[model samples]
Target: MNAQDVINFLQDNPSFFEDNPDVLTQITVPHHTGGQAISLTERQVSTLREKLAQVQGKLSELVGFGEENDSISAKVHHLTLSLLIAESFESVSQSLYTHLTEGFAVPHVQLRIWNSILKRPLPEFVEVSEELLFFAADLQRPLCGPVQQAEVQAWFGESAEQLRSWALIPLRRDAQVFGMLALGSEDAQRFFPEMGTLYVERIGDLVSAAVLRHIG
Candidate 1:
């Protein structure tokens, strides 16, 4: 783990090893002699160090999750501010898409509006695979994270791998799905449900409102 993560994890889990006194004794010292306790030895120190390394690895995983969550939070904040100040839908969509791709380190992204006349979702942005680019644009209902992945992969086959993980968040207004913002990363884990969705959902709500005000 990095220095900040190390400090945060240690502070948060001060009692992580409390129940396992054997592990504690391996790293701690006896307060008094012949008091039914023993001090750590050189061998114990090595073992404790090994355990520390393992714990640090877990902490690093947490650090990564924290980073993604923080990125989404920042992007949502920026979008909120922009909405309050902006005057046009095009400007808002462009800014939002750029922020989404950059903050998530995704290589491809698209924003689309649900086209009721065509009975399908139409692509507002097309990158990489064009064959299935407009698949999610026409869906009248909100597509959740899991279903969105299935639909894209089903339409594109092997080509979807080039974009890796993808998330289609429905932009809803007046209880209707008006549009969606799709974010894609080369890493499959980037859009997995295990990852935080606070930012994505918040962005979806903003996009929905914008679409309602401008397109709905």
Candidate 2:
């Protein structure tokens, strides 16, 4: 009666085709490329081929994702080993900066420690605005996107103007946030709200543990 009804009837009675093989030759459907009407059998074959191509394309996409994850995991592993062997706060900073900037190719790194326990008046101990400290404390996960705070951008010093994007990782010790490690790049697309932050969050965890050793 209707196209859907015919489809349902054919689906329900799959043996109908085998019982009436002549129907396959009589039925003709428009060709996928839109020229002549082809036999139903030919159309079915064409449909299956299209489905197979789509499945293969999806499989290739999945393989690409797997390779990307493996690569990022390896880089994170290398950073872990580098931090594990660091002897002091200075070395920890060196190893973290070196691994992220050189190994991961992040162009700029900014670290700020706000805990009063940081007795040394190093650059890290430089005063941070209460607003920033609150923002860091409120972060449940790493923030990835265009620079969220303009003031934070100025912390990068001379490169502030050129840095258009940022990944702000909140460092926490004993569940309390203490500081932030900011990664900066000139490319706006380098960091965005929709981007995955799994590895960046992992970096935050590693950095927090290493820095807390001396200042916590």
Candidate 3:
């Protein structure tokens, strides 16, 4: 019989090996590593071992991801505590920069508030393009990917050319977007399109609260 026919027969007859016990022991398959021919049972055991190893490898990868998420969550909590103690708008900005750049390892950050009600504003309250403000308002979630907004990219100063990826988060006041927090990274894969933005969104809300306390 052909190889396919034999495979079909074995698959169709589940109890064939029990019925022909001698034939099961007598059947030989080539060794996977180019060694001597091994019995069908040895090959089956070897295949199971390989599958188990693959499953173990996948489990270890998942464990590594879990540990990474835990570490990031701890960092976010630390940022939240720092923001809580902030007594001024500048204090809030300083704490955010320290936490994101030092604690979270993000290198470039730019914050621009277009709708602040303050009579006098620092560099943070600079006027931006109407189009940029509209774009920020359109975002339902934090946008993560290659840099798309040219006007926002110019806000990074000397680091603008070096940045390969970006995360744009809208800061909301009164459920309306009034500002944006831009984070830039040199690594192309740092802020990929598919990356999760849960922590990013929380950071945006924290910054919004801090800013709104003084200039809402």
User: Which candidate's TM-score is highest?
Assistant: 2
Task: Kindly list the per-residue Cα lDDT of model 1 for residues 131-214, writing each as its tens digit.
Answer: 333554455433433443555554444656676576777676555555556666667666775665666677777777765565
- Please give, for residues 1-216, the per-residue lDDT of candidate 3 as tens digits: 899998999899999989988986798999999989999999999999999999999999999999999999999899999998998888889999999999999999988887778724577788899889889889998999896789999999889999999999999986799999999999999998999898899999989998888776
Rate residue 138 of model 1 by lDDT: 58
| Tens digits of lDDT, candidate 2, 1-216 | 999999999899989989999999999999989999999999999999999999999999999999999999999999998888888888888898898899889999988888747656577778889999888999999888786597788888899889878899999987889989999999899988899998999999999998888766
Model 3 accuracy (lDDT, Cα): 0.90
lDDT scores in order? 0.61, 0.89, 0.90
How many clashing residue pairs appear in each of the predictions shown? 3, 0, 0
Off by over 4 Å in 2: 1-5
Ranked candidates, highest lDDT first: 3, 2, 1
The residue pairs found clashing in candidate 1 are 120-138, 121-137, 121-138
Instruction: Identify the leading candidate in terms of lDDT.
Output: 3
Q: Ranking by TM-score, best first?
A: 2, 3, 1
Mark the regions of model 1 whose C-alpha exceeds 4 Å error after superposition: 1-43, 60-64, 115-161
Model 3 residue runs over 4 Å out of place are: 1-24, 32-36
- Evaluate residue 119 in candidate 1 and report its C-alpha lDDT on the 0 to 100 scale: 27
lDDT for position 61 in model 1: 96
